[model samples]
Target: MSGIYIHIPFCKQACHYCDFHFSTSTKKKSQLVEMLCEELELRKDEIGRNIQTIYFGGGTPSLLNSEELDHIFKTIFEYFKVSETAEITLEANPDDLTEEVIKMLNASPINRLSIGVQSFFGKDLKLMNRAHNSEEALRSLQLAKHYFDNISIDLIYGIPGQSNEQWKRNLQQALELDIPHISSYALTVEPKTALEKFIEKGKVKPVEDEQYREQFDILVETLTSKGFEHYEFSNYGKPGYHSQNNMAYWLGKPYLGIGPSAHSFDGRSRKWNISNNSLYINSIQAGKLPQQTEELSTTDSYNEYVMTRLRTKFGVNLEEIQEKFGEKYKLHFLKEADRFLQDGLMDTSEETFHITPNGKFLSDGIAADLFYIDK
Candidate 1:
């Protein structure tokens, strides 16, 4: 099924390692929302399907008040065919979550809440420059659980000084709370980020890949023992609680993405909106969609398929490949894949080729190697 992703390009504060496009000022909030709504209406026919999920993701979607949120949802309903049983989600930060806000969200059509609880430790919070403290982080989940059962929380590990014991404690705490889904991430220092600068200046320690791998292994073991399925590389879910919106991406479904810096993908190509807030608004006001797009060549399409599908539990299907790209390309794909099979990174039978547990950590690299070059 298809989905919709709306990027709310605003945040109260910037985290040290974040590279996402967002503004700390609320001066352009109304204008931004209006532009987003207009973009939604403009791209209606491009994605013609009953949307099964609508994800409000961003710097922090909870920054918007109930009225603004309502306006966006109403516009989506007006311009798009949303399923009656669609899974609508909002990505919230702990500091923005309060009893009143929770009540407003519960009243709305949003069925899922993905709270950003990067760490429950005050020390870790300070290092990341998250807006919320440990107390608010814990309280947000407690208060949220009272109202919503379909909840997913995010956690970060492999911080500069995070011990293995502390990482284990984080997962244990989530299990104790009975969270249905969790999205755990390893901290990486992206170029030009504050974290990268800190490391370069020797003001902060750089990330240890070995330590990160250790933590990742702990994550897989701990979550699996807790009866959570490692559905994707960084996602774990309880039975029947997998995220429908994320699954749409892995299944290669066509979806519309609205707002500044949001990305959309149809099976054949990809498109993304402009990252600059004022520029995007100006373009849309001039009745032009402010975006860049690319038509995927066969080689690029096959590479993307291997990269995304390999991350999911449902591996790549052989017959589907043959059907889509033909027998010759499928055979070439298998020939290239044979290299990884010998290394025990992937397992294959006559019908399916799935990454092994050992292969999960090296997914990106292996997928890169499997990329096809057009002749």
Candidate 2:
């Protein structure tokens, strides 16, 4: 099934480690919203099918006002065939999720909430420059739980000063809140971000790979022991609470990504809109799609499929690979995966291959090693 992703690229302030495309100044938000609507109209025919999931990801989607949200929804419903039971999700920040906002969101079409609660500790929040304080984080989550049943929260571990005790406390806090789904990730210091600069200037300590690995194990053990499924590497969900939009994307289902810097994937190719807001607005206003398209070669598609599937419980199927990509790719995959399997980093049962316990933290690197660079 196909889905749609709407990116709202405005934030209250820049987080230290975030390198996502967003503007802190929201003066142009209203204009950008109009452009997004126009772009939706422009791209409706791309899907040509009923949308099963709709995701409002961001700089911060919770920042959208009721009127702004309504306008976008109206535009979507007008042009697109959305399923009656579509899973609609919004990514929100704790600082922005006051009771009134939560009530409004519950009243709207959004049925899922992914709150940005990077850490439950003030020290970690401050170090990451999160917009919310610790108290606000807890308060917002409790409030959201009252309004929504399908709730997810984003948490980051392995901050510069975060101890194992602190990380455990954060997970404990999430459990106490009774959140159904969680999207937890290790803090990566992206180039040109404030965190990288801080490390270079000696204002922040460099992130430790060992620390990340330790915390990752703790995350897996704690959540899975509590009956949460490690569905994807960075995601944990109780039964029936997994993110539909995420599943759609990972399963190679087509999706039309709306708004600036967003991406779209058809069965054959992928494309992305321009990252600059002004340029995107101008281009959409002029009735042009400000995006670049790349037609995927068979090798590109196969590599992507292998990369995404290996990290999940749904392992790569050798039979499907052979059937879809021919004997050459299946043979190449098996040959490359042999070393990892022998190293005890990968496991195969019947025709499917999955990440072993020792290989979970290194899934991405292992996937990279298996990627065939077409010469």
Candidate 3:
């Protein structure tokens, strides 16, 4: 089955560390919603399979009023063949999930709520320039659990001055809430973000590698002990609560991504829409897609496969690689993986290559070393 992702490129405010394509202004909110529906209709024939998942991700999907959300959902049901039990998710910010908003969302088709509760502490909130406070974060989850059973919350670790004890407390809070799914990530300093600027100006200390590694280890150990499956490098889920949309992405299933800065991938090619909201709306109004496409070369496909699969619990399937790509790619992969395997960074079982706990934090570097670079 396929999936659909709709990016709502608007937010109430900008977080210092965020570099995603989003606008702080809501002036184009209505126009953008309409254009999104139009884009969905325009690309209705792209996915040949029934839609099994629909994800509303972005700057903050919760910023949309109930009517706007309804309009998008109505358009989706009208244009696409959605499965009877499709998993629908919406990413929300804590401050936007008020009682009224929660009530409205309960009436909508969204079955899952992925709350952006990065941290449960006031110091961390202010440091990131988050729109919500610690109180709002706690209250939002308390209110949300009353209505939505399938919920996930984000947590950030390795803030410049955040200690391991603070990180443990964040984990404890999530466990106390009994959230079914948790997506935690390290605080990365992307280029051009305000965080990078602060670091450059020496106003904020940079994240230390040792601190980041320590927190990551704590996250894996704590969650796994609590029966949360470390299914992905940055995601933990309890039993059946794994993110279907994200799983579809990892499995390389085709999906249609609507809205500015969104991406779509078929088996052989990948496409991304322009990152500008106004340009996207204008182009859609003119009956043209404001996007670019690239055909994946054999080496490009192999490298991508290695990158995505290595970060997952399933690791890399050698048989699938040989059958899908060629014997040459498979042999090249085995030769590259030998060093990591000997270094206690990876292991093989039933002909599958998976990362060991000792190598989890360094998965990205390991995957890169195994990349199929062309001569």
Candidate 1 residue-wise lDDT, 1-375, digit = tens: 678999999999989999999999989998899888899889888878578999999978999888888889899899888899899999999988999999999999999999999888899999999999999988999999999999999999899999999998988888898999999998988988998888999989877899999999999999999899999998999998899999889888898989999999988889999999999999999999998999998777777888898999888888988887778768877898898899899998767888898888998888887777766
Model 1 C-alpha lDDT versus the unseen true structure = 0.90
In angstroms, the error of model 1 at 352 is 0.8
Global lDDT of each model?
0.90, 0.94, 0.95
Enumerate residue pairs that collide in model 3. none
**Count of residue pairs whose backbone atoms collide, per candidate:** 0, 0, 0
List the candidate 2 regions with Cα displacement exceeding 4 Å.
none
Of 1 and 3, the candidate ranking higher by lDDT: 3
Enumerate residue pairs that collide in model 1: none
Off by over 4 Å in 1: none
lDDT of 3: 0.95
Residue 246's lDDT in candidate 3? 92
Q: Model 2: what TM-score?
A: 0.99
State the TM-score for model 1: 0.98
Cα displacement (Å) at residue 262, model 2: 0.4
Instruction: Give the lDDT of residue 262 in candidate 2.
Output: 98
